[model samples]
Target chain A: MHALATLIALSLASPAAPLDWHPDLSSAEAAAEESGRAMLIVFR
Target chain B: MVRPTTLLSLVASRFECVRVTDMAGVDLDRHRFDFDLTSCILLQRADGHRYHTFGGRTWEGAESHLSVPALVRVLVRTLEEHEKAELPPRGRSGPGRTVEALPPLARRIEAGRRPACIHCHSVHDWQVEAAKEAKRWRPQDGWVFPDPREFGFSVDPIEQERVVSVEARVEGLQVGDRILAIEGTPVLTFGDIVLALDRSGDGPSVRMRLLPVSGGPSASPVERVVSTSRGWREPDPLLYSWRAMKWNLDPSPGFGGPQLTARELGGLGLAPGTFAFRVQYLVDGGARAETGRSAARAGLRVGDVVLSLDGRSDFRSVDHVHAWFRLTRRAGETVILEVLREGERRRIDLPVVGLGR
Candidate 1:
């Protein structure tokens, strides 16, 4: 319950504007592999 | 982060930046996390081998967080390492599909909200809750993001991967030496150290392989086993990762800081050398009956200044108080806490619980 509540609070706390974040994880991984780059996972 | 703004395009072009949509379900078991913080960053390869993990801040202000310059430096180094074919795959397996996917709070939530990524912190909470259910969790378990500094060595956070110093008894390692492998695992960056220690978990000694930072295969590598003292994996109390233990009052015990100054300690009848933590924030774990068992059972107040535990006050720092309590004491054990509530020093016995209990 604490986990869910904190999640809800985080969703509500997000700023009005959405940043240009990757839409999905798999696509990001695919992009990284094709580009020969690393994956940066930002948890906020 | 401001400095990273100018380099944002550079990072975007060089790496895949992802904010995983839903990390609560399957992803919970996929990636292993150490600290429970509001914000963290993990760097890994496309093959699922991790590079480095950083970014837990105290949030006092902009100064409290990591600098953009530091972040950029690390990015530049990681990119270079990748181009040179130095980064390796580590701890890689499936995408957690076969792992236990249900979070602790899953049954309490509406079905529609079950898979949602409410908060990144939920990942840590669920992992802790799950560990507790299986009776494998420990109080010192949250020190998952251990720092080399805690071990008396400082590694260049970026490409050099060189040791800055040997502060403690890191046998056979010294300044100017670079780490090659830890516990037989090939490691290239500080992120690798984080991953290694996270996987190490409550071990008695830390074994590391070292090489000359002067960069020549001509020199043979040396192996060193750094026998640790108690609380070896515990990050220093002042670190952003340590804040993962901050003050909370619900589904789990929350730890917070803004340690008491000498004046505050004096006000609480402590001496100039006293170490105490002033709780400034409250983490409401989740919903619980107001009258039932909960944080209220602990009888600790937000402003209460903790002086010692079980008559032990020889702790190293304010944060060390909590680390010592959690690391040394076992679950269901009673710790006699000497605290000052509104200038009145009283002893309170706190029943200890493991990390997420």
Candidate 2:
């Protein structure tokens, strides 16, 4: 029950405007370097 | 995971984000983390130099230390750190080393025994196999990613990086203190702290720098060194039993069942909290058949009630006994079991043997 509620909460909490998530680390690193931005790599 | 706040969305938008669900192509050396976690985040530069790691939990629960607000705070802090253009501490980056190339895993793959899909926990499984294959497996090798509470401090879950309380003996620290670094490596999340402790491994002491809440985040940090004792990383025996890697350890008890209820214990003239459990079945025919056979040959039988192991009766449950055995006992030792069979007491000497040795 707790797990279900957390899943629901996470679904509701997800931002509506989808952030552009690179498919892999190399691509993300290339994009970060090109755009001068940091990389937030999430392992789920 | 950042909640749908405008500030969070704005902060998250500035970075290049990636969600990795599999470890297939991940460079193990460059992207090291606590595989025990279901979710982890790494804030790093384009060059793959890590600024700090985020995510981890104690045995409390999987999301016990996770907070969206805290993640937002970390994101903002990481952006600021990025703007400073300072490189991460030395040794933060590594030569690429993929998980599939891990020696044991490579061997298994070559033998056509590769898992269909490699999940986070599979990483730990491979690591244990590697250690065992090298003939250097120890009980303590199972202890990974030790929590901060093991060192006499509790990090505030919501704040994520601040100390909420300190045990009396942990000198030079106080409640509301913010941890800046562990062993000179900057730490902004629970994952970072655990990684530091994991790297420290059985060391006598750890040194950390703290920023007191009274002086706020800009305070001149104070240094504190705390010594660790033997078995300092050991969690509650019951909690330790939940580890996936426990199955890779040796000396299984060969038999177990539910802990006796209070009423059952009362009927049997036993104390409520003492160790007492009935034997439901012996592992007579399986991968652990030898263990069950050894216990049975020593006079252990189904329907017998185990009272204590080696005269120790403080265990919380039958599983606790099994965990304690694997964690503390070696292969060649003999364990004396006090059991009750048909209202008569008996002592059985069960020889401990290594599994898959």
On lDDT, the leading prediction is 2
- Give the per-residue lDDT digits (tens) of candidate 1, residues B283-315: 454342331133347776677777776787776
Off by over 4 Å in 1: A1-21, A33-37, B1-8, B25-38, B52-65, B84-100, B109-116, B136-143, B149-152, B156-160, B184-188, B201-207, B213-321, B330-357
Give the Cα error of residue A9 in candidate 1, in Å: 21
Q: Candidate 2 lDDT, tens digit per residue, B184-286?
A: 7788888888888788756657888878777875788888776655556665455565455666667787888888888988988887666689999888886
What is the lDDT, from 0 to 100, of the residue B11 in candidate 1? Answer: 58
Report the number of backbone clashes for model 2: 0
For model 2 chain B, the run of ten residues with the poorest summed lDDT: B86-95
TM-score for model 2? 0.79
Best-performing candidate as measured by DockQ: 2
Compared with the true structure, all predictions reach lDDT values of: 0.57, 0.76
Model 1 DockQ class: acceptable
List RMSD in Å for every model shown. Answer: 7.6, 4.5
